[model samples]
Target chain A: MVETDMNSQAKADRKAGETVLVADDIKRHYEIPQGAFGKPRILKAVDGASFTLQRGQTLAVVGESGCGKSTLARVVTMIEPASGGSLRIGKTDVVNASRSQLAALRSKVQIVFQNPYGSLNPRQKIGAALEEPLLVNTNLSKKQREAKARAMMAEVGLRPEHYDRYPHMFSGGQRQRIAIARALMLDPSILVLDEPTSALDVSIQAQVLNLLRDIQKRYNLAYLFISHDLSVVRYIADEVMVMYLGHPVEQGSRDAIFASPQHPYTKALLSATPVADPEGKRERIVLTGELPSPIAPPPGCTFHPRCPMAADICKRLVPPVQRVCGTTSWCHRPWEAETESAA
Target chain B: MSLLEFTNLSVEFETLNGGFRAVDNVSLTVDPGEVVAIVGESGSGKSVSMLAVMGLLPWTAKVTADRLTFQGRDMLSMRPKEKRKIIGKDISMIFQEPTTSLNPCFTVGYQIIETLKKHTDLSRAERKNRAIELLRLVGIPAPERRVTAFPHQLSGGMNQRVMIAMAIACDPKLLIADEPTTALDVTIQAQILELLIKIKEENDMGLVLITHDMGVVAETADRVIVQYAGQQVEQQDVKGLFRDPHHPYTAALLAALPERATGDQLPSIPGVVPGQFDRPAGCLFSPRCSFVFDRCHKEQPTQAGKELGCALCHTPLVAGKPQNEAA
Candidate 1:
């Protein structure tokens, strides 16, 4: 059984292309029922969102809470199936794979959730929790899984003595390390991190992010890092995708997004971030009115309601990326010698 | 004298695990209209410290302080009636989640009106007018009609604004906002912080902002108090703390934060936060501090000096070295 799992992983590694994950126009909608029985309105949590994760690169998807960032991560990791659109991982089309095929795909991508306290089962020992993934994915003997789980625990910077401790015994940062180990039990090529260190302390947050970066470089892994923290995103993301109401408002390299953003929403978000620099003098743009509900987003562009540069056309049509500047060129205005526009 | 002074404040709670000190011997002072941010991690006692000052802790909790004098009044031994009178009327509070803090059964107007009516002998029409004025003051639009709306009808940001409006209904001298904008979006959080700063200045109200984000302190705080593991590691003016943090913990904290402008990749502190079970006798930050020497492990450093030199520093001051050197 151990031999079979090893052989499969080896073959899978070879078969897997450099681009580990591809999410094409992914849509994850849920029918949230209102009232007794009338028509149940659909919530397009991931409304036609699309991005790709290449080997050794971090694709940070950032947005405010309730902007469907977690929903997008769930779909990318295949925890919750997409309502529409396609998701391909390592040349394998997983959007509609069979039961066995999906199971195989699960081993290829794994997710590290937000709360370390909630993710691990308190009933199970640290060793047992880490062993569960190996037990499910590989046809390994109990003893083999136990040994592998111990090694994986060590891989995440946990001591071997911590194997028998309960989840409550560890600090938030250590528990996050344990969660990372559990996710790596199957040696996944892609990791979908959903605010993995949000619950940890600032000093500890740095350690966890550093550990993730080290691991990513060591394994040549693709990361779909989802977080609302702009500072964290700036640190780890190679490329960034800004989402508003489940739609990709901007997609570009990290340097591009931080240096000069074209989207007004992105600009506001960047300006809104609180920096420790006493010298930072970027004028903050406080958008009037609340973020429109995802259930029934504003027509035309999702950001038109809050955009300072909003024009008549912005309120009538959805904005699409027309070019790439620093990150992926994202803009609603036409690209030419210079098409004058805002919003 | 400061507008509000808290000296040697400590909070303890009993649990199945045993008695744990939620807040250590912490001391701070908020001058009139100054924003003093108490910042640290989840269990850093920032929230508990402020709650103890407000006398809002549950029955299970115990509080002790050598001095908790607000405007020269003994806060620790004040009569329940006296404390109650001062709390809403002179020193109001705000929490992180507004929905839970706000009474959902009543309109925002009623909540503010209750606060007003409890303290002032005002008529219903006057209270309603004041409520509308407050709602508008906190950046909530169309406050005249919105005051009648329930808390559920408002957005998170607006609800927070309503919460702030209710807090400042009586023009409290001291405003204690505990993680007030932690749950809000970044843009909303910025606006709320800005509003807090504006209101503090306009009203000349002393502000105590408790949060985990160091960046928030750097942006909004006139003074900064950094707590860790229920102990105050450092306290200084915001400029001094940012420019030349005396404590190594404060330095590490400043270093840990990722700067959007600085080209340097963020440098994370090593190791995890210490749990209650493993809190050693010495400095709470010794395990994470990069420059820890013999004294940090062997002997605990006391809160050294009274004002400008209050932090526990291992490195001796070098002769002729500049004082306000940037890290």
Candidate 2:
């Protein structure tokens, strides 16, 4: 009985040690003036977005260009300050961290940007770019850093000789690999990969995705992946968050979202994504009208202006985040599981 | 006879390193009201080949072609002003980025009105009337209000519709859409592509769509030209190309696509496109070709390479050409 108790305690402690990225009611806002010397308008970017990124899992934040997905990522990654809500990175208060404190916070997370060329220096060699993080953060010797850089390159499926070559010499996919290697330099437990393979070709996209999956398995790292590409998000993400205007309208497990999405915005987004097959028939939820300006976002429900099922109440009151078919959505009319099954 | 024809055309861009041939000796034809998709990966020379036909090639670009005729006019022999007359008025072109393509300083309505003024001899009132009509035709509601909005103010999809509104402002004979929907989301892309096709059918205008998307080609194109390393690898009907692509490069493109079909393994081509300086002596595709034979390596082949494999036009084929013989 004592032996069994001891084993259970060890398992519990180990489970406790495993970090889960929790964003509790995260909010960020920017002040924009209405007129010259007039009252400042509080432009809420992300208003109370809450989710958790468990260890060895990916949580995709998907939305249109100005939907505050990038802002959420930026605020969560400590690149920008959050206005309200607390960020617990394995019990560490990331939202309140100072520059040096954030620098120490760097040991936990890293980011791989969207533009492969923009993220990587044009003049710098791949090896040097990969070695930069190690040199900055650690007391590792020059030789040790070089060795780590080369190994990281191989981990990302780039050749060792590519170390000498610059970013310009490599293809879009190859350049992305270099960027991934650079991000891995800190041995970061969490990676906020922002549209990592968006610029790459289809075949190269597959290769890079496979590499990411392999690395995730090896390192057991958490990912806060941001992408507008649905197919890629479906492939890599364990849980998905759909953002609209400045709020997370829908979020659930990958299977739950794909097999049966509850939110109308999520449904519309899925419909918007062009399936590759020429013969494949997708019932398109054609969303008409432009995404309203962030400065003057629509009252109550942001998507009401273009939503197919918007009612009078939908435009008047903000819908509660109610559970529908096990998926949570800030929508008045989430598709019920029984209705989905019937359909 | 076809509206546009290319015979043994090759384009070379002179760089500091050397004269790099961006488009090899190629031949293609576009009939009146026909939609021809030129599909290939980046650096495949599909866009460059079309650019050559438009006489848009610069002074540094050495264009060697036996014949590049447009409606019986020798494009290669045309003067500067004569080409300019045909470029926007008779042959309008739409670029990928509608945001960047539309000038930010001016309103979309004014820009489109300017296009009408440049191409046609209409009064100020007549031009405004036509501009509003064009905007409406492209499915923009309340176009009068939208006309005043600058490119930055409009959404990406809306801006693209405005660009189409401008491109078709003068009712050109042939529309060159170079990846017009590449930057757009799927639903918006569908709308734009459908609108373009509808306009083409309505006006009976020839279309030259240059894109890397096979899905777009399969859905819209009647026929297609598969390009690789500045050369025509395969030319077939859309059905034929998608059903049974001939050239290895063409096959790779189709295979590279991830379909909605339930399949665990997605087809992927192993190697990357070779650099300009490092192009192989023989077939540009030979290094990556799965079924490369002896002749594919030894002889530097061009347009004629496509002729040999062509099922429609069997041999006696050209010296280097292989056509779509694959079943």
Model 2 segments more than 4 A misplaced: A1-19, A97-101, A337-343, B72-74, B77-80, B105-107, B260-267, B292-295, B300-327
- Stretches off by above 4 angstroms in model 1 are A1-17, A32-40, A333-343, B12-19, B59-62, B103-110, B141-154, B260-266, B272-277, B305-308, B314-327
**Candidate maximizing lDDT:** 1
lDDT of 2: 0.79
**Looking at candidate 2, what is the lDDT of residue A2?**
53
Report the C-alpha lDDT of model 2 over B1-327, residue by residue, as the tens digit: 677887889999999998999998778888889999987778888888887777777888988999888887888788978888888887888877898888889988899998888778999999998988988999888988887888998888898898898889888888989999888766577678879989999988999999877777877788888777777777878776666655666666666664532344445666677777778867777777766667667776434334233421221123224443351
Model 1 gets an lDDT of: 0.82
Candidate 2 docks at the CAPRI level of acceptable
In candidate 1, position B124 carries an lDDT of 88
Clash pairs (backbone) in predicted model 1:
A252-A327, A252-A328, A253-A327, A309-A343, A323-A329, A324-A329
